[model samples]
Target chain A: MANLTAALTALPAFLMVSLLLLAAVAYLFRDWERTVAIIAGVYTSGLAFWFWRMDLSQPTQMLLGRPIQLVAPLTVGDFTFQVQTLNAPVIALGLAMGAAAFLLAARASQGHTFVPLGLTLLAGYSALFMAAEGPLAPTLLTPLFLIGLSAVSAFILQAGRVGRVAGPLRLLIPPILAFPFILVATWYIDQIALNPQDNQPAQMAALFIAFGYLLLLAPTPLHSAQTSSAETAPPVALTLATLLYQLAVLYMLFRTISAFPFVVQDAPLASWLEWAGLATAVWGGIAAFGAVHAGRLWGYSALHDWGVILMVLATAGARSLPLALFLLGLRTISMFTAAAGLSVLEQQTGGLSAASLRGAASRLPWNSAAFLLGGLGLVGFPLSAGFPGHWAAFQIVAETDWRQAAVVLIASGGAIFSYIRLARILFGPLANRSLLRERPLSAAMAAAILLISVSLALAPQLLDGPVSYILSAFNG
Target chain B: MEQLFAGLDFFATETGVLIIMAVIGLMILTWDWRVALAGLVVVQTGVAAMGVARTGLPAQWAGVQVAVMLIAAAMLAISAVQTPTSRSLRQAGNWPLRTLAVVLIYLAWRTIDVTIPVPGIAPDMAGLFTWLGLAMLLMLGLSDNPLFSVVALLLWFIPAQVAVAGIVPHPSIFALIGGLELLVTLTASYLILVDRLPAAARRPVMTDVVFPDQEPKDWGVTDDAEEVVDALPLPGFVQDMVDSGRAARRSQPPALPAPNSAAPALPLPPGGSENGETISEQTAAKEQG
Candidate 1:
């Protein structure tokens, strides 16, 4: 048991190396089923690792009559990868999400390199969340490196597929643009270390760091990648990539705040985040109304959700942090469920445009229902998985200022209205085309995801464990 | 060789800034991809030279930077060659807008005149960084093509690269930037290549038919070429080609009957004589069909 604990202590490096190796091996296989199976296995192993580590952390759950310590940091030279209390649950959530994506991708047409690139991205994001410091600073150079990896993976997933490269190409922009500000901010930090009394360097560092993270967050104008990719890129792959990347971004933000509170306190970062997030959410809803493409509509709804999450984070208090994290967890579920349905619909309908999907529900009713229900969930409609979290968030925000809450409610109305319109089109009269039959496997997967979404919605307490787990780090 | 090396100092002067500006101008203004690629190579090398002359970065590291830039340029050059439609020599459609953008970039740089004393950089290099940043913005704002956008992204990274080299000069940072530069360039090149390929060529070859006992069948597959192309709307450039193909076929004159050949007339259906078409027309239609 001690040996196992010791091995788990080195889990960061081990997971990174093994996941990368598995990705490479997965690439060699031409069979997508085999490839997806291998990816699922990798994520499953990651989940199992997390479970084991979490079990060990509990004193009551003893191993060999001794309580083993949780996984420790593995440092080599300047690089450090640690499964700290803060990131352990996040890492577990990421792995579980990846596992779920693989399951959904089992019957979806993820591109040829989806498995390999997906696994590689999974490894990169895990490292991003776990990495405390390397070469330059924690979450600065590290996120850029991982973002670079994601851009490449996005390119591979999107390239040679019949679509615009704007989404994948836009992924390249944030890292390149953020690099200088972050690097220079690190320099300023060094200067601050030399002269602690003079707050100028710290101020400059805070402003630069805020700007850099804003770019990384990619709200509003920078959101072209997310919106455009949603319209063009493969649904399942985009969902997994987006959810994982956003999870890392959230973790990075939390860590940066912990390390440098002045960014929020001294600088105008909170206000900026507040306004930007509000704009993003409002724009998302408005855009969703105009989005003729099903995928684009989903993208806008996600942006709206992300905006609300950001608003929650920007609110003044530590409680806002856990609430925001909880909202993100719900977002992961909603997005995955939506993407699952969208993928099958895209495959059966040959496209995601409104014209292509007109009267599609009559043939593939279950998948269509999944798509509609999941999309509605994103808007925080009642009886959806995201309802409880969103309801709590709105109540919290309303406690502070009712106008902000009113604006958010109105924006959510836009998305819900769009979904209602889409539902009409989905359940509209059938055209006189050839019979389009849904595959049994696809229907089964859609049914399963729909069931999970509904079950979670019905029993929101199921999320209590995860919410508390995420909050544990904060409490400590 | 030593004299040539000394002569290279010409790029370290005020004239060097103008020369670099002109190189980027050529990249933005010129329609020929080869010319843009040439400008890309020259600008990257010139930036490295300026870094070495002003910032005091190691000459060997500057050489490494040049090599990496050259490789990126070569990858783009190859992609441009493979995607012939991207290699037009005609003037850009928006050349006037681009020219105005360049002028605005220069004006903005002149107006800003950032004079802050950066820790590891010389005071005079601020103008160069500002111009590069503005030009990069212009390029990114104007470009829709993957090849040009890749060049724009490279421009965006150059100032940062120079700044990092000046500020840190760590071997690890150098390696990291070089590797990322290569990776981004490679990905953009791939995007360019695939963006130009026919839709059928880019379509995924596999499907989600992972059953144990069932024989693989074309379920939900668009097998016909026309159907495949028509299934989903094509991108702008590809759609333009399709439209042109349709137009060319439409404008083609029907083949006149070969001066006096004894060819049999094509048989019409039993109920097809309502229009009263000539036999020669029937034969010509048959040949076209």
Candidate 2:
């Protein structure tokens, strides 16, 4: 038991090494889909089982009877990795989505790059979550994360259609620009930590950190790269990169912002976040509403959801934090389902433009259902998983300011209208009756994903326990 | 000899190096490719010299810095060689905008007060740091070409590193920054190569340039190409229309063609080859006639 606990301390390293090995194997045996699937299945299931045990067990009793500490920090040189209350659920969710993506890719003959790149992304996220706990995390891990993202972008570009350079190049910019800001912030924070009297640099550092994160999130004005990629890149790659990577960045942002209470409590920064979030939400919704490309609609919708989450965080109240985290989790599920479904539809229809998707529902009913259902969930429809989280966030924000509530409602309305527009395009008349049907296995996977989303939506309580655990950790 | 040594040391000072860097940045903004490339090398050498003098690091570290700079320069040179002649010759902008930016930036830099004290750096040096940082940002903001943007990004890190060197003076950080410079340059080179590929092999341009109608004159079609297009044979009614279109075009010129004029050719349906070949023959015949 002690040995197991000790092994757990090196878990990030283990995961990274294993994923890299698996990537090598997958690359070498690109033709062996079953082998890749088996490797991915084993890794994801192991991660799920580990997360389950970590979540269910007491911190002291997590590793058998050895009285192991789940939140024990593992230091390797200058960096630290730990499975804490805040990140356990996030890690679990990331792994689950990764596993789902791997399976979907395997079924769709995209296992070669998807499994390797997806696993690498998961490993990067794991390290990012762990590293984000400390102030120096950005200095040490930001480059590593960016490099990993660059690799994924490169892989996607290579696999995608010719002349599709813009998407990957766009993905590269935020990280490249972010590196220096984070470095400067790290230096400032270190100075402040060393000399408590120095508060002047703290403000500048905080602003840099916020701007760096904003770039990382790629919210509206800076969102072209993500939107371009979403419109052009393969659906599976888009799902993995956008959902998992963005979630990690969000989590990191929360950690960094929370580290500097001075920054969080400052009225100007908080207000800035609020206004930015609202603007991003409204802008994204309107953009999504007008998007001609179905893939880009998914991107814009995801952007809108991120804005909502950001607004919730901007409230900076304890109650809103959990709600924001919950919404983020919901977003992960909805985006994966939406992107996966869109990928399948894109495969069958050869494009995801509004014209291409017109009447697609008649041809690919299950995929269309997944896409619409996912979009509805994302928009916080009554029965969707997003409803409870968004509702709680609105209630919290509304208590403080009604105008913010009005903005939220308007944004949500725009999103709903956009989703409806997409639904109309998807469910219009039968344009191509002779369309090839999706394989039963692929359809089954899509159905299973849709089922999970619907179930989570219908029973939002499923997230309550995890959310509470995370909140308790934050409070502690 | 002592006076000469003292003067050389003066150029290596924080203020002197920053001034030199600013001048190089200006050169980058206004100069042609060959001169700009030379300016970049000078900028790097000045930066390395500052690192040595400011940090009191061993002179070998300066050599390492110069080596990294050479590698970066080599990458830019390769990319410039590979880039199409038109794009390679593409200026950052006209002299007027460049001059306005320079004057504005210089005035702003000279007047602005920097309150946040970067540890170990003198107040004047800190101001220089802030100025160079803003200058790098301006360079990035003004340029759309990937090559110039990457160069701006590479230069952006130097001022910060110089400011920090006097404070922390860590070897690893410098090494990391050096590695990052190399990584960024390599990535930029890759993007240039990718950008220069035949349109059929490249990704679709994703930029939604607002004033596409305001494209630069260098990108304008040559009169010879227009004459060639006008000479292309057309059916009787189409020929009459083409003549009218030519007259209209002469009055109000067309916007620059898409970045890759060859893109439209690649997507022709497989069965349309005969029709395409026949049209090509007719155009050829018309030109010969």
Candidate 3:
């Protein structure tokens, strides 16, 4: 057993390689939905566990009387994949989210490629976080390229049999636009390294980097793809893909700031994040109010919640990341719960349009309730999982500027208002129509999700230990 | 040692410019899917050649780029072939508008005269690339068909890539870019193929009909509603046509079933069918009416 453990520790990049290989296996067994889901779920959970238990401080340890070399960086050819202590928890969070998506796919339908494609994306993300300088630096430019490629892959995965390709196609535009700017920024960064005295290169680098991240962050006008995708793509796939990309981008943002302090000192990056957050949050809410489709409304609500998290991120840069992550953790629960219910609802109803879902609650009561409560959680309504984090964030923002808090509160009302409208339609008169009944296993899954949400709402303290551990990664 | 066949020298020449322009123009102007795809192959080949020359990229890398482009074009062609309903050899609709747009884009590119600051590339080559980029962008904006849009998008990548190569000509970078292009092509092909698939394959057939408990709406005027149609107070010509049609229908026997068939020998729903019309025939007639 000790020898086996040592052999595994001797290969640090083993997890990434295994993830990729497992993804291929999942693709091969995609016809067996249960098998694919099981493989994906177990593999991701295993990865999360590995990251959680990793002791990066120790390079070598005695295992069964043999010295086992345990290092973070794994060199493959010229490229090195390192486990950055600061990014481990974030990676674990992403993996956990992926695991949830996979396990849910066991019961719900997230399309044919959701498991394999999702696992592939996770592998790319892990490689990205663990990458160190070789032929290309892991800093910003190489990741941008990887993101562009990932976006193309995502576009394919999201395009399924659904005829709406517009949303998936829109996702391709931002990365295409961001790449050149970051490429130029990298050149400028190299120039700065050669000539340290001149602030010109740093300024140029800052400007270009800002433009790149602005597009990558995808606030306001650039947010249509996300909303459109939610309406068209499978909910679980959308949740996993969106969360994975957002978390990776968040980490990239922090890493970029750490690498170049002038980004905050010389550039208006802080203001950009703050204003962008405000606009995005407010717009998300207002948009939600008018969304007639259940899927679109769910998307808008998430967008609004994302806005609040962004505001938290803008508060004190790295200092506020833990709070933001806490909110994101709550968001993961809300999204997973809602996606589970929504996927089942879409499957039975054949569509998510408001007219199609008339009196859906009368047929699939448990799933309906799950969808409703989960959506409400996104808007941070009282008695929901998201309420505590949102309320805390609001209080924290109000301490610095009460008006900002008020804006967020007022915007949140828009999603709440939308949810209320959705609730009426769901529970209204049956209208002499019939819908497919929810499966027993599906109901059980939804019940489990509901229990988790209620438990989190009642005992918000359950998140403290994880959040604090994640925060410690950044504290260094 | 003499430097033989130095990079991008051909692209700087007038002949190279004309060939590039002709290929792009053919791609944008042609309505034929086959012809458009042919133009795409030519454009990609030229891009690969130019990148190899300009950046001194390895032959293997250039081969990879060319091979990927060929496969992408083949995928698009296969989809086009599979979709029999796709129009072939038809004159492009609004050709004048497309032509004018193309001309206007080219004029704008020339008028702006903006210098691209890509290192180690000639000025003429840069100008040519800029023009090609703008033309591809225009094509992307104007296209409505997914196949054509994908082709334009792929073409746009060439110039952007050449610029990137000029700045950082790493083999890994080129390989990554090639892989992404292939993935995009695969996705576009899948969408095109699926779009042309039968309706049942796209969405659940159950959603096509109203729930069993809900009554389906009757939009057309039935025999019982003839009076209502007559009372609409339509113009004389229209009313005459309707009356004539009804008279013609009355003169004819039932569209289907024998005059002494088993359909009439059996019990029939009251007022639903006359003569020896089968239930299916009656339903068809009702639908037609």
TM-score of each: 0.83, 0.78, 0.78
lDDT of 2 by residue, A131-217 (tens): 633334543346436644664555554353544455665566677667656666666767777888877667767777666666676
Q: In candidate 1, list every pair of residues with a backbone clash.
A: none
Candidate 1 per-residue lDDT over residues B54-103, each given as its tens digit: 77767777778878888999998888767534332111234455566678
Off by over 4 Å in 1: A1-9, A38-77, A473-476, B1-7, B88-93, B112-118, B199-289
lDDT by residue (tens digit), candidate 2, B192-280: 66654432111112231323212332232222232322112433543465467556645663344489573222232233233443323
Best by TM-score: 1
Which candidate gets the maximum DockQ versus the true structure? 1
CAPRI accuracy category, model 3: incorrect
Per residue, candidate 1 scores C-alpha lDDT tens digits across A1-476 of 97655654365766677678877877787366645665665566556465535753543333446443446567766778877767777777777777776766676667777777777777887777777778876767844675577665666458348535767877777767777877777788888889999999889889888988887888887787788789888788888878877777777776787788778766898888888888888898888978768999999999989888888888888679878878887888899889888988888888888888889999988899888888888879999988887898898888878888888889899889889888888889876277477888778878998998998889988877878887665443
Error of 2 at A142 (Å): 4.4
Q: Give the C-alpha lDDT of model 2.
A: 0.64
Model 3 Cα lDDT, one tens digit per residue, A413-471: 98899899998998897653767778888898899999999899999999989888777
Q: Give the candidate order by descending lDDT.
A: 1, 3, 2
Candidate with the greatest lDDT versus the true structure: 1
